[model samples]
Target: MTWPVVHISRSLDHDVAAVSSVAGNPANLPAWAAGLSSGIRQEDGRWITDSPMGVVEVAFTGPVELGILDHDVTVPDGSVVRNSFRVVANDQGTEAIFTLFRRDGMSEADFQSDADAVRSDLDRLAVLLDKCLLRTR
Candidate 1:
């Protein structure tokens, strides 16, 4: 199944090309995406992240997998969560739609928390792009 996602961000620099460049590049995800540990793999049209939340695998235009590990204190084992991101140009900035698909038995509260994390990431992205452009000039 698929889930509806929506997010909007505006950049002060107004450099559409630069904004687009950063958004499309999966390698740049860790630079701006909050709670992301590292960008591990970038091959065969996929980007992998060693995320604190889980092992996140993101396709260039497919889907993202967020593994929910089994720890005694929290979530149980054998649970896998999937997500996706759709980026589009909006005025001078960009709008990112994050789609979330989860396994059965998961709670809506978890999904809502995930949405909040995306909001934090978007804020980071704006600062990242601004820093990037400043360094180039």
Candidate 2:
């Protein structure tokens, strides 16, 4: 069965490169990604963190210069989730879009909750970038 994909986005008052520089870095995940804010550490070339569900391993694959922030999360049960995120230049500022694929067996309510979480995380990211931009100016 094919899962449905949901696109969530947020506009940030910064350039694409600046947004990508922070979002694309695994080390910065805890700073903006609420779900992973507890903490993350690298072990054996994999990023590991403890989620509410359990321990998860994350693998990121994308080009920072191109603003591609795709990553895969391996749950403790061995299931893998793919997250597609990107930073694009908009007329007024930069837009960060995240594509979330609903996992198999996920209920409608669960999917909605997941989307909300992603939105919140993006909001946090925008705030972080805004603060950084202010500091440089």
Candidate 3:
């Protein structure tokens, strides 16, 4: 069965390429993605991190481009979550969009909380990008 999807977006005052460069790299996840801020390490070609739930693995399977940042995250329970992230050009800056899918058996409250976390992460990303822009100027 197809699950529900929640989309959260934030506009960053930075170039699309710049945003994509940082967001597309899994190494930068700890800096922007609060959910994975505990830490991320690589083992046997897989990215691993510790979450409140437990140890999880993340794999970024998207092409490196200006607007694509897809990845699969394996939770501690062994459930895989697919995230479709994008960084698109907008006016003089860029807009980052993150797609979250409601997994099976997830309650409405849980889904809402997950969406809020995504929004917070996107906001943090914008702040990081803004700092990068300032440093380059």
Predicted structure with the largest lDDT when compared to the true one: 2
Off by over 4 Å in 3: none
Best by TM-score: 2
lDDT of 2 at 125: 92
For all candidates, what are the clash counts?
0, 0, 0
lDDT scores in order: 0.54, 0.88, 0.85
Tens digits of per-residue lDDT for model 2, 28-73: 8998998899999999988999999899987788887788888899
By TM-score rank, best first, the candidates go 2, 3, 1
Q: For each candidate, what TM-score against the reference?
A: 0.60, 0.91, 0.89
Tell me which residue pairs clash in candidate 3: none
State the displacement of the C-alpha of residue 20, model 3, in Å, after optimal TM-score superposition: 0.7
Off by over 4 Å in 2: none
Query: How does model 2 fare in lDDT?
Result: 0.88
Q: Which stretches of candidate 1 lie over 4 Å from their true place?
A: 1-15, 42-46, 52-56, 62-84, 100-104
In candidate 3, residue 99 scores what lDDT?
A: 87
